[model samples]
Target: MPMKLYGVSDGPPTLGVRMTLKALNIPYEYVNVNFNKGEHLTEAYAKLNPQREIPVLDDNGFYLQESNAIIQYLCDKYAPNSSLYPNDATARAIVNQRLFFNMGFYYSSIGAYALAPIFFDYQRTPMGLKKVENALKVFQIYLERLNSKYAAGDKLTVADFVLITSTMCLEAIGLDISGYPLVLEWYEMFKKEQPELWEIAKAGMIELAEYNKNPPDLSEMNHPFHPTRSVK
Candidate 1:
């Protein structure tokens, strides 16, 4: 009857969409898929999202996937006036560019290195550290450009959400983001700018990180933690 959202409890992509809904004051039902249990691979969930990813949104009969798209849809349909998406060309272009960079550049390096190493327990071997280093270098460069003027005009948009999500993973993976003063400033600003939503997001991230740190039961999920994991 009402909007239904399929998501995982611990994934950042879904968390970003959920937070956007909260920030925009949109109400929806959240359905949690246990990724570790491969619930997403079941035929029932596949009917909702063929890709078997979390953060799928079903509104009446309309279906949507991808975290950014879900957030944009909520903003466009429920709160067109929200600062999440800019109306102007330049500002919109900036947001798009940053989003592009986020996906194209940072996604691979960061996901494989920082996120996999820590969250997946792939082990931060030399190769893993190198991948993380490359990603962090890109993050540093990216943050340097995010002065008071971020991806869009002077407001917080989806771009900031995407960056911050990945940054949370980066921080947990043993990267010292403090070297980037502007990034630290921006992180503080994102938290201060939306204290309530940020607090909720921070709590979610902390829970995810803590869960990842624990020794997972190999039988809990078919996917066992990669051997050679380093204890931090």
Candidate 2:
């Protein structure tokens, strides 16, 4: 049986999983879980992932959540020898480091600063934006040190997929990416090299941009990230 992925199309983590699947040419069934409709909060979905996160991977009877873990699992199981996820201990270590960076710093910064205010109906704070810039600067330093064709090294890896999705989120929010020259260059390279992935991820980005232009009134709706709908 083909794998099943429960996800929201426009979600960055979900898109990262999708991009990884596409790049690895892995066959899977996509089950869209609409956040707008609160499908993810349903009892059935919560049984699958108590956290109510998207991009839950159902591989036969086995189920998994968390996008980065899902990506690494796929690569380890399906594409062990693929350069996108190297088998070498040292190289793989570097890739793992980058992936953790994405989860801890890069994606977190984007979510807190860029996406949170727009989607959850909060005011954007200067402190939040500064944190994001600092995260970008760290990413820029990574690129400078490796000085390779991709995030982990010359060869593309799951790290690229993870980081690029977060970067795309930053772009969707109208951040000036030019300040991070290495990131900008890397972004352009990824666009040209993986045009199809870009195309797949772009629809959600366009939707996000449009949504930001005229945000919905979430006063009546419960904030999914918070219990009391209080801004963080």
**Model 1: pairs clashing at backbone N, Cα or C within 3 Å:** none
- lDDT tens per residue, model 2, 1-232: 8999998877889998998899999999999987755677788999899888787999997899999899999999999989998999999999999999999998898888877776664567998989999999999999999999899999988888888888987788889989999999998899899899888678778877776676644445454555322323
TM-score of each: 0.84, 0.93
- Estimate, for each residue in 1-232, the C-alpha lDDT of model 1 and write its tens digit: 7788898765667777777777777778888888766677678988988887787999988999887778778877887876777767777777777666666666556667655654355655787667656666666666666555553447888877766766666665446767666666677678787787676567656765675666334344444334433345
For all candidates in order, the CA lDDT equals: 0.69, 0.85
Clashes of each: 0, 0
Error of 2 at 66 (Å): 0.6
Q: Which candidate tops TM-score?
A: 2
Q: Best lDDT goes to which candidate?
A: 2
